[model samples]
Target: MHAGSWHNRYPGESRIVLDLTSLISLYDTALAPSLVLVCAGLERCDHRVLGISSEDISRLMRKLTEVVSRPDWVGSGIDQKTLIHVIVDRYVDRLELMQHLLNFTSSDSQELLQRAKLAQAQLRVMLTPYLLHSTVVPSSDTSGVDAPHWASLMFKNCATMHTSVMINQILLMTSSEHL
Candidate 1:
């Protein structure tokens, strides 16, 4: 009988009820200090919520290269080792995609750019929770245009790689209009 698992014993009692006043109070009590820390970091220009440095990236890549792509690992049994490997592999894939996005370029084809734009928008829905508006605010805001949607996708070590192509397209469109 675990203390937290009391809910498991009485399933109906597990429901959480909250009114607006309680919710606001909870936010003030629990989240306010966290927000202050975020503000302090912003003041110090310390972006990246999880502080993902290049060493982390390199380590992840090296470990992933050593483990996940191995043929023997693919057919391995579903044990603790295999599960950890699978999770690491996924994280590595995300990091690779993030790297690709950080160096993203657009094709000359408008149709392809359009397709990429559509895909980028779709990707944003899933990415919003991971993104921060403050991180996006300092990016290039050309000719009064707001920061491109892709700029907002930087999170920890992963970003919206899908949006880089569209960002190039946006830049081209804005630049060409002045020419």
Candidate 2:
């Protein structure tokens, strides 16, 4: 149910767990940092009811994983190979965190997993710049280009092509990674 609808049904309910996918999908960066905090908090809740095994933690981990799609990747002016490395490193970190979370036997395993997932999400975002700079990219001076577009466009020769090849390799590895 929607928040208003849910409120209508249980105005004085003691517990309410939200599914934030729809809201986060509409995000501008302005909301991301705050939403990440809210989502992180809700993810730490204990929402068991009527004897059902709570899946909030599992649900949250999956949603946070999905919520990481940043449109900034499309035209951030970073070379493509650099983008590829960043994405792969991010995914690898995600996988490692997920793996660690999967091994827990704590009484609060779900909460722990939720926390770990959030940590990973934040880490991935923070590490993006480092990943982009991980490769030693050759710099091409745009001394002649007067326009910003032309100047920005000149990072397209070796830096761009190499990035494309690197990105393709990362995609191939990611695809076959599950096989």
lDDT of each: 0.48, 0.51
TM-score to true structure, per model:
0.19, 0.22
Worst 10 residues of 2 by lDDT: 44-53
Candidate 2 lDDT score relative to the true structure? 0.51
- At residue 50, candidate 2 shows an lDDT of 29
Query: Any runs in candidate 1 off by more than 4 Å, and if so which?
Result: 1-108, 135-179
- Per-residue lDDT of model 2, residues 1-179, tens digit only: 36657554322343542332234431242333334434442433432222222354445456666656533323444443435446566478666765565655667867987877777776776555335343343446745545655434445544565566567877999999989
Error of 2 at 52 (Å): 29
Q: Compared with the true structure, what per-residue lDDT tens digits does model 1 show for residues 15-57?
A: 4532212122212323233444444526434533354345545
Scored by lDDT, the top model is: 2
Clashing pairs in 2: 80-163, 81-163
Per-candidate total of colliding backbone pairs: 0, 2
